[model samples]
Target: MDTLPDPVGSSQMDIETSQAGGTPEVANSAAKPRVRAPVRVEEAPKFDLDTYIANYTGRTRYDRLYLIGTCSPSLANEALKAAIAEAKASKDIIKYEKAVRALSEVAPSDPEATLNSAWVQETQRSVNAQTERLEGELKGYKNNLIKESIRMGTEDLGNHYYRTGDLAAASKAYSRVRDFCTTPNHITSMLFKMVSVSIERGDWLSVQSNVHRLRNSQSKPEDAARNEPKIAAAWALAQMQQGAFLEAANSFLAIPADLGDSYNEVLTPNDVAVYGGLCALASMNREELQRNVLDNQSFRNFLELEPHIRRAIAFFCNFKFRPCLDILESYRPDYLLDVHLQRFLPQLYKRIRTKSIEQYMIPYNRVTLDAMAKIFAPSVIGGEAKPTDISSPFVQELIGLIQDGVLDARIDMEKGLLISNQVDLRSEVQRSTLENFREFNQEAHWRILRAQVLYHGLEIKSDKKFGDGGKGARFSREGAGFD
Candidate 1:
């Protein structure tokens, strides 16, 4: 995010968290509000639950499925069912219970929603026994003062804590392992734990910090290559979460290809494409979009996963604004269901639309309001639901953009056109020249004053006039002695 380097040949990347192993651990305690029937509604998300889930493995599968279930009522039953199956296969009873509870709310008749007390009890016992055993082993390692053993032991405990959904405990355990790390791999492993904890906890700042810590680590070249895509994706995720869209775009674009399914525990290649493409469209200009997006060889592989994003970018680059926007709108519902993207989707779309409008007017002195409305606000124009007038939403948006200095065009309601406030380059250059000359003259005067003072060996000294206790004495500089 900070560097926004080129996608290919960049050394920066991201990876590993509590679900750092075969299973991911998230905060099971943080309750979420349940969403009503998602698929049952007329506005169903176009996202395929099975296909999206296929991109991930380990604990993230359950985490994402649980999120989809809770948030999208249409997908709730299917998502929660898959989440339950994942939890059943794992020892995370807290997660199992949560999923079961949520499912019961959504589909009480579904047998999977019925919490299995026996499984919960058995898992609880297994977890307790494992925790005690790991704690004992960690104590023995600490007593022996074995750095590697202690580090491993701490990580085990941390992973266990993570699995049990003890987020605070897991974070603490992960942090402790850093003190005992003895190698680059060790440091990398420890940093991954920290990143995972922070990610699951929604501590984006901490996630970025850990990513930088690893990015700056002295890992072997081969290992760094293996982990680069994920860390970069993770960093970009943090950047996106923090509303640093353009910075996030650069980080996402910087992620190399050939990652395949290796980094899917947190993010899929499709995520990289979707996230990077949208952000680039929203932030980057046409030239940047062309060079960094459409022409980016490394990112091209990721773009292949979602050809729609590629088409959107191509459409945008080719000045086909309405088609580009239409494609995005068609996918909005599905994108809205994405856990990381939902919060920023509205902002991203708004930015893309405004930028398109801004770009559309760049070559023109003026455009008819009708033309602008059709391109930017087609739904609101000439519809009984929204009156076609100066007071309409499209006009309001234009007004806001104009007022905010984002658009250099203004509405000429009398003529029904948006007129560009074009600049006279000759006058602008003359004005710039005058300002520079004034600045130089002012600087020159100061320089002369300083030179004269220095030449005269100016020094401050108190000169007594005729006053008690030097009260009447004033400090004066021995100056150029001007007559």
Candidate 2:
């Protein structure tokens, strides 16, 4: 077997011998192939590209790019290629810029090689210029690089914009936040945000739609506790906007104090008070107001936000007509200017006034006109208030209510009193029963008489026809043969 020459020591000795003037050609011939020691380069730990990118939330996009570009040229190339492919597929200029920048950093030119360092720098500069040109496109893409984070972050940013009153921009930003929410709470939160935006834009239909979503979602207990009041408030506001006062009032009253206290963005506590109080006054009876509004602990908590409204409701429920009207009158300006309450104010006040009249007269057989006027009239606050007379608008309104059957009483102008139209239940029932019985008896007598007439008429006709000479009549009675 042929052996290989020693390349290390022999090559050095041949150089020494040739320098020492020994025959140069013989020294060179005597030199063996140098066997160099094996190189031991410490390889860097390989980066798992899939694992790194999979966990990447675009927050660290630039950082990751720097790490790959500086530490691992191969991984940088892989990242760049992946980014390029994504950019092309998605038509994202930001990703394209990222790819260019990464490539320039990863592959710098070597001067000793055919491609000089200056050429490399020039190429890098060109890539950088292109990247800078596309940098403006990168502003929104950072969040979007990671799907989940983007959705939530976009929602937060949308809310910020909404709060700042950039409504159009806010809506546009929110539209980009797709509802990829995983939990019920998250879904409800998304819906609430949408509702808030709708409310801002006065898009009541959209608000109601989102409110429906919030209502149907089954949130966690904590989330429900946190979110239910806001949802209720939004629903009530939307209903009020639509002039569905009855439903809106119920929704407002349903909001728990804790939630109501926490949520003031859409409806203040005072607004809730006026809304619920007025709605109850308009649609519900005194009994309902007592039961559903004044007596309800949760709803009362909300009303406590505006104590006067609560007082008004209590007064109305307790049949203090004058006091209730006074309290409502005091808040007239506030209610008049309220976005939700203003539209309903006049109707609501009228209902309260009518109810006051009805309830005031409920137990009385007769009330003086002066007394009725005193209860129904809005009293002047500061000066000596005039005694409201029968000819006043207050009395006129009461008269109208009575005529409309809203108040089941009659005003006697000559007697100068309000007379309650009381019907005796027992007497009415007995009279109705007696009338029915008499009608039934007459009907039975008529039926009997008509039957008798029909029977007699038939009998007479038969006798006349069957007088002994009538053959047709004679053949029918006995079992005789027809001749």
lDDT of 2 at 124: 43
What is the C-alpha lDDT profile of model 1 across 42-141, one tens digit per residue? 3567778898898887667887787677667778899889988887786766567667777888899999889899988788788778889999999999
Q: Kindly give the number of clashing pairs for every candidate.
A: 14, 4
Q: Which TM-score value belongs to model 1?
A: 0.78
**Superposed Cα deviation of residue 387, candidate 2 (Å):** 7.8
Q: Which ranges in model 1 have alpha carbons more than 4 Å from their true place?
A: 1-42, 385-387, 424-483
Give TM per candidate.
0.78, 0.54
Query: Best candidate, TM-score-wise?
Result: 1
What are the lDDT scores of the predictions, listed in order? 0.78, 0.59
Candidate 2 lDDT over residue span 1-483, tens digit each = 112112111333444555788542223322222322212112332336665455333212332332343334345456555545443343322223334544554453522112234543454455445434433333455535755666666666555444323345456666666455667766776776777666645678988888787777888787776777777788888887787878987888887677634554556666677787788787777788889998899887767767888888788777787888887776675454343454467777877777777788777778887666556653522222443445566667777887788887877877778887887566788999999999999888867766776667532333556665776554331123111
Candidate 2's clash total is: 4
Alpha-carbon shift of residue 391 in model 2 (angstroms) = 5.5
